[model samples]
Target: MTERSYNSLLSTGRIAGLELSNRVFLPAMDMNLCVEGEISDGEIAHYTARAAGGTAMVITGTGAVAWPVGATSRHQPAFSDDRFIPGIRRLADSVHAAGGRLCMQLCHHGKTASVDTADGRPQLVPSLLEGGADMSALRDNPMDELMRLATATHGKKATYKVADEDDLAWVVDQFAAAARRVKAAGVDAIEIHAAHGYLLSSFLSRTYNKRDDRWGGSIENRARLTCEVVRAVKATVGREYPVIVRVNGHEYGAADGLTAAETAEAAAMIQAAGADAIHVSANAHNPFADFTDGPLPNTVAAYREHTKTIKRAVTIPVVAVGRMLPEVADEMIAAGECDFVSMGRQLLADPDLVNKIRAGERRSVRPCINCYVCVEQNFFDGNPKCAVNPALCNEKVAVLTPIARAQHVVVIGGGPGGMEAARVAATRGAKVTLIEKGGRLGGTMWFSQLTTPANAMLVDWLTHEIERLDVDVLTNTVADVELVASLRPDVVIVATGARRGRPAIPGAEMPHVLTGDGLRAVITGDADADLGSIGGLGRVAVGVGRAIGLLNDADRIRRLSKVWMPVGRRVVVIGGGLVGLELAEYLAERGRLVTVLEEGKHLGLPMAMPRRWTAVRKAAEHGVTLVREATPVSISKVAVRYRVGGDEFEVRGDSVVIASEVCADTSFADQLAARGLNVKVVGDAANVGYIEGAMHSAHEVAREL
Candidate 1:
């Protein structure tokens, strides 16, 4: 085969005094892979995997610049003292051995630092203000001056001692000291964390900093602390070591927030003050901030637009983030919109993304679905976990290499689990066959893809993997006892999936109503003939009928309403999972008065925290009324009956949509068992979990097989 010639992202790349092998960089991500401010063997292995996979420059997770005051969590690593040097040294050495450059990100959480990690230290800031400090940064003061600022409020301790000029200087000095330590650890470069509303970012935004001093006036004033810190670190580390600043190009909500031009000005000041480059991202503190979307949100292309503006304004290289794909990165670099690409969650999904591109194995690259599990994990789960990459935060575990003895594997159901099993088994040199009752792969995901744009990536990723591994797919073929007996494999994996159970309520047999699966069939034009008897059959109704329950049907109503009753002017969605909430938002956007009623105490309980918050906020913003702690007792033609707080209430709606409860398919499992073949259920087949669980289960089962 002819060698493919391409511009190397690693070769001839230099930022500040440190040289990089490529333009691809692993942006800082909170993996929670560290062990008590130290790098664990898993952290080492995880990073080493990325380096070995061919990342030119790997930036370690955020390292605290100031011990207790700056650290966000107990699991985060610290670069404040010589004690951390050995672990960092090993990380840098490992990257170097893999022919990759390594950079350490010096971070200070500021008000975001949790009190647990602060060890009773006060979370100080430029000003003591509301929304300025939370429980995460609350600190106890022993000093008389600081003690006076402590107040008991709402059964909690609140401190109001603002950080004076002296305090600011001390923080800057701590950052400089941390930088020097990182350099001493033999790391190639240092990146300052000024994004994500951290201490430096809080100072840069007017929303967080309300001081009337020089640091609180204009954009220049707000940016003064950042510039000072950059200069101090540069001076402390000497001229040769590279220093980069990671900053948000836009703060998203604050009207007085820094704009692209102001961000450029700050970047220029940092560069002139000895900074090497600017890693540009967006502020996601506000629900409205564009960056608050998932890692690979559908609007990623729009996010990349801001990078172009910042790149044009700055002289130093600009590292652009915000769900950038390899092709997108190439285009941005080729267009001079960004000098390098920084990917946080994308790297977590596939550390070898760059290598896969270089090897022309793009199909093998795992795509981030932008579900926000990683972010949710960092915030609520106390660790970062990727939905697509189970080994992401737990890279300390041994990578499962192919077993010496390969077994013939039978994977039932062509969803994520089955596909993953087949792919991994095939990779291990096992003979694999993936069987799906439907004519295509992506079982329940097919329905989800229809309703949500973010979920479309799931279908794409699964299909890519199935094809790349050359899994023998037998679609539209039900796996029965005769079939399994004929195939007779060493291991049978039953991902047969689940089915919608009979609704144990009155009107459950209503022809007008539909299950999630039935709705999906209606929306996707795959409705079984059984649904044909529903009244009000017309083009519009049929179209909607065809797309009834598919998750991604942006136009199901429009397509079917012409023949059927136009999607009722008023709509009510039951359940508050990702599907229910998203459908409510979609319908509300289309001018429908939407109401969502959930039986849970909180809306979006089924979803992970941060993502659930994001979805709930979006639904509320779209004028969708969410009724939590309410159970729908009955759905009538004119109103939805529900019980909340032991009180009965009714919501009027023309059309009622059921968004809760997914039925798992278990026929294949029963059939496999009847055949006396060893079978293991995974994904939605075992229980209704997210794609991450399914893929992880599949991978685990494949290893055993």
Candidate 2:
């Protein structure tokens, strides 16, 4: 925990002649905050927040070498002409004044350039990609999302112009010119993007580049385009200036995809071509399902091992790009695996991550949760915002300045939303008291950790913040009109969460049938198991375990579930919403024969696109039977009868769980409001946005009180 322990992480790093404050670099992430080629003030504020928060170097999202010609997204930053120099200069000045360096990423989104397609231009490609990415996963997206993605290109057709000898020369010159423009704008460094299925990366990919010319075949030949770009960039900026080339460490989901050995060879070739550093990244040959395996990976320390492979191949500094925790990055650097580490999504979740780690306040740093909420916005060309941190692109609105008068605040319920409100209110010099009827602070979110482990970090963080801010917390105490009136609270917030109703089916009250709440109670030991539902003497054993408080700890219960659980071996989940699908997947993974009956066509509708796609695919892989447009008829002791297409079907299951159809419950808030008390509803109690909605509503309400 001492400063000396993080010597390598906090140590000064040099890329060519440029000196960085530390080894932590903000990876290039497309925020879609710009307009055409112009950078917005909000965009500058976003980078300025991170730079000021203690990032050694902040890499700007991909700046198109030719705006609207080879641009992927309509809102991506552009440095193609001198007209955009002022915006780049402004960002550079702001970042430099904030005590951090600035690096601009030069990109040309070859075959996937949406702007080019919209503008009726033939996009330049190394060789026209034979087939497109697997887009079957997108079928799970809602109708609105599908339409938005379709019209994002403005209803234009795409055409390709294969790059010939003359075309290659033009591409190289464009990159050199862009590099010159960036240097004129006083940018500290330039990162040549040759990863993530971009223009140069396609040439680097052996499978994508099928030309039999000098620009194809061998790995060295296939890497020629990227190497030339690196050389041209180095020449344009001169030898003292930094030139970092980002290449894929490995390409996933392709038989002939670029491998680690190929990438190492490419890195060496790039270094020989006058590149000062290599930023190692991975790419998914298939963008839909394998995306989590690539550029914006969901795994912790995803590209850590790949960097070790590339580092051994090049004398130039190696930059590792993926999700790297502070401790893991430090250990990676200390072991001479990589020189710099990029924490992209983590920094977006909490800009002060570096400062927090530097101050030994790592516990206070907010977690990203890998929810992919931010990534969902890019499909619609909207600026990205964090699920937990509501003030990502709107930093000014996040000011926590104290109010003129101190007031008393009371928050009903101790869920994520309630606890967040309490934390924020207390921070703004208000007296906050949080009351919960349950014995534990976290509501259902604690049990949600059974399927989503990342959620635990969020609950832990909010609890820490609540305690740190000195908000009075009362567990096992109910919030009522009498109790709240006695406290004399100036403002009250109700975050009691959603309401659930069991399906109107025959034999709904059977002892073997459990509601979502019933399942939670049984798993957390908040409610004892029904003897009628349990087997002979095993029922007695479960009751004794609950009575003795052995099931109090969630982790212990999760561990015990693998060996023993009160639920039956076969499970039938009603309603294929987020809860039902996640529960189905979780149960299936635990060796249960699970079947989900959904009245609607979609599954995981409430989740983000990437996570939803993953959940559906994984559920299928785990052998979960999904029946759409199905209405439950009745629940027998052993089988569940349902109707799919006017035909009756019966599926045998030992236990049935109803986890569908949620509605907003504002009865408590309405009662408090009718009494003339300032009342606000947040989280699922107001709407069902899950964690993102909870955090957003909490921030909005807490800032006012």
Query: Considering every candidate listed, which one attains the maximal TM-score?
Result: 2
Best by lDDT: 2
TM-score of every candidate relative to the true structure: 0.89, 0.97
lDDT for each candidate structure:
0.71, 0.86
Q: Model 1, which residues run further than 4 Å from truth?
A: 1-11, 115-118, 131-160, 287-298, 396-398, 404-406, 527-530, 533-567, 663-667
Q: Write the per-residue lDDT of candidate 2 for residues 27-106, one digit (tens) a residue.
A: 89888888888888988998989999999999998878988779988788897889999998999999999999999999
The residue-by-residue lDDT of candidate 1 on 534-555, one tens digit each, is 3455335555544545323435
Q: Which stretches of candidate 2 lie over 4 Å from their true place?
A: 1-5, 527-553
Pairs of colliding residues, candidate 2:
none
